[model samples]
Target: MKKLITATLFATMMAGTAMADTTLKLVEVITSPERTETLKSIVGKFEAENPGTKVEIISLPWGEAFQKFATMVSAGEIPDVMEMPDTWLSLYANNGMLESLEPYLKDWEHTAGMTDRALELGRDVKDTAYMLPYGFYLRAMFYNKKIFAEAGVDGPPKTMDEFVAASEKISKLPGKYGYCLRGGPGGLNGWMMFAATMAGNNEFFNADGTSKFSEPDWVKGIEWVVDLYKKGYAPKDSVNWGFNEIVAGFYTGTCAMLDQDPDALIAISERMDAADYAVVPMPKGPAGKSFPTIGYAGWSMMSASANKDLSWKLIATLEGPEGNIEWNKRIGALPALKAAEKDPFYAGEQFKGWFDELADKDAVPTVMPTYLEEFAFFKDSLAIKTTQEALLGDITPEELAKQWAEYLTAAQQKFLASK
Candidate 1:
């Protein structure tokens, strides 16, 4: 009778275990059909491997993602796991909204295979990792061979001065512009790249935590942009052009060159002929230095998540070798997994430019001051406003430089004080 009772209790416990439900809400930041579908497929595999743990994907459009996510968080509708761009990762992690993955990473089998940079990408000021990077986005210059040949420019510009000359030459073509300037939203990249290149050093702060935008070299970089705009090197209408407009400008023969990340290739490849264009390392500054920035997107677990272990399992599967390669293949981003560096999918002529940038010892890879939550404000608002003013001849480069220095110094002081 006792043996029978034990068996019945064991069966009841087993049934209870099977009845427990753990649902993970995963928010996808990129809402493209292909990417969303690929994520669903990966989630399906994860669900199969870990029965009774279901993942529900919440898709957010890239355009409205930030505002919408802010609203969701304010509304207390936090997900179990969410796509975290490096730009937003620090902000979220710093605010204690993210679950630090340090403990989980120490025992994670996949952590051993991740690149040092990939592991470091999600680190906060205190060096605690809150996310695992899925992929990297690095800048390279894409140029039109047909336009170059027509402009009599022998090759891609090697220096900022040469870049100006090439742009001028290209602009001589009727109804064509030299550079596909991203003047609208997401235009901070062009501003930062040029400013850093001109400054010789990409570092934003000095030893005492002072900002560097007002430095003479950085001013020169801002001057270059202003000069280009006043000289009609870029389309006048491009002052309001964002990613779609800029890519269309390049692919439709409206612009001769564009400095962009590998992800831009996915869209460009669909519209432009391969033989007509090629990518190269960004042009150096007068100081013979080029600071091409790199950014990444990763997966982070919300601190509010009730199923941390299961959510981590989903992250591991998605960032693992097979899944990383598959996702990057569709996104045209560089896989953050170190082993993926040798994947055959990235071993193509079309990918040569990014590879060249990565291999170029002279080209320094840079990331912006994403640690500051106000950085998004600077990126999406201040930079755009001042740059558009400079382009319109409403502000001199020096004035623009001073404005940046004053604003960033204040932000830097606040950030340091908080620390």
Candidate 2:
């Protein structure tokens, strides 16, 4: 009789444990079909491991993500977790929108894997830790192995001088543009057009909380980038080409080199034979240090989430070694995980000739959220046609810089007020 009673009590306890498990309405703003599929698979495993919690991912492209989310945030319909770019973090945080992740980060093992730079980059507009970095992207040179061989160059360039010489060599090719520069497209793809100018100038709004964007050092840098567009090396239509057109140009042999993010590497390799493509570091400038544009992608947990603990558990697995490899593989993104640097997927000739800057432990965060306006001035003043005409001898760089300073002064007032 005692054994029967004990068995009944054990069954009752088991039923209670099952009921405690709950469903979490997780909303992730995934950008692509491939990434959506990858995330779904990752979430599925988490649900299986931790019974009773359902993670529902709400995939949204960059375009649709923001506008739709604005409504949700206003309606108090925030997701359990979501993804965002580090640069936009300020706008959200300043509006009293974001929940501080500092409370949970204090003892989380996965959050511990994050580096100092990662944490710094995730700081809110107020310079407080408000989010966690989930993934990152790096700007690099994508070169055609065939083009390098034809130009009599054995490998990629190491310095500013080597880069200029190589571009000139590639110009000798009958049908190809020497080095490619993007034409502007939508606001979302605008980064490619402005990256070269930003790196060459070492100018990204003032790093010290000032609006010194038109400072002499950065002005000289814009002068150089404008010259590239007017020289006939970068295609005339580049300003309007968009990412698709640029990718098409690289694939069709119209251009010898492209400045783009590493996330495109997987697509580049998959589209053609692996032998057709290789990547290198973005070239150095007057500063004498190789600077490639860098940026962060972030993830955050909602303060109001009923299953907050379970949500972080899912985050841990996704950021952990196994899930990161799977997710990074699908999207061609680099995992912030240090061990991912030496992943076997990055091995062999496919990654060869591109190993020089593979692990950018030295990369600086491309731009903080504050520098958006400053970045705009350079692109309008020099990257696009407004400055292209001046670079081509249509107007002097001196004249261009003069007009640029006026715009910078006006913009600086508003930008500074926010700080």
Candidate 3:
């Protein structure tokens, strides 16, 4: 009788211990080996601080993350927390999948330290805090100093005319191209930047909810990129190049210039020498202004999370001052906290171009039309196909502009009507 009682008590104790432990599921959509390492390090500290909690990380490749995450949610495999990009926030938040972080933010110790821009962007969806943004991604020009010197170019271009002149000069060099054009996936930002700069404004739609992409200046802008490729200024094989290909092109010296967000710096800085290249603000247009695209990503909790309080605690740990700085260091984005900008890491010469852009009166940081529910499809599917067609000479630049304008107009009008 005594032996049986002891066995039963031992079984009960094990069950109680198991019940005491909690495991939170974390999904990272922008998965990279370095990013994963940083995330794990931060999460390790969180786990250490909370004795009875563990976080299970699920990383999905960025290319297929949108669709894969959506499918997972639909199939009832939702995570406790996720890395939410600017483009995917509305889709999940509007569909009631995300838990508003406003309540938690009010009580968080680091809330006061967050930059106003971070809070503003976090409230992008329905004016509620569905996510706590970690950092900002602003586009800037990266130029190969070695390639420029070889081509006899004096410095980075400040104007569109100068940009073209430099490209022409660089293309004359043996087996060299001027621009690492991302003509495949993730090329929409380049298209938008060029069009907005040429149009002298970052306005996407007019008073009547019509897209401005079909305007003459916008058409000219699109044609200019097409002409760059046609004139052999961009690599012939670049029509199918995506993010990785373009970055490779820049570092390998196949191309002289690349306009990319700061996240790219993480990868570029790894393989290239600091003195061999330099970052600069995107060149201006005829109107003496440049519209560089700005984007952000954040940590969000799911509505279905059973451990809401614990999930919030994890979020706070990741987005808090020290954790945020550590994450952004690995992620290569501008910190979202006002205080973090003062960190010595951001004061380096590589970050000078982005800071200069922010200070420049003529450098407009343009936000994408990500509020539209159909924007993901428009950007990942419709835009890619049409832009590729234009790049390949299968469709004229005017046709490409008109198609984009019509699609965006419908989407914008639908969004406005729903409001």
Residue-pair clashes per candidate: 0, 3, 0
**How do the predictions measure up, each by TM-score?**
0.91, 0.73, 0.95
| lDDT tens readout by residue for model 3, 10-87 | 998887787557899999988889899999999999999987789999998876777798789889999999999888
lDDT string, candidate 2, 7-58, tens digits = 9999988886764556666555547666788888988998889866677687
Candidates 1 and 3 compared by TM-score, better number: 3
Where is model 1 more than 4 Å wrong at Cα? 1-22, 417-419
Per-candidate local distance difference test: 0.86, 0.62, 0.92
Error of 2 at 143 (Å): 0.7
Lowest summed-lDDT stretch of 10 residues in model 3?
Answer: 13-22
Better of 1 and 3 by lDDT: 3
After aligning candidate 3 to the native by TM-score, how far in Å is the CA of 19 from where it should be? 4.7
Question: The CA-based lDDT of model 2 is what?
Answer: 0.62
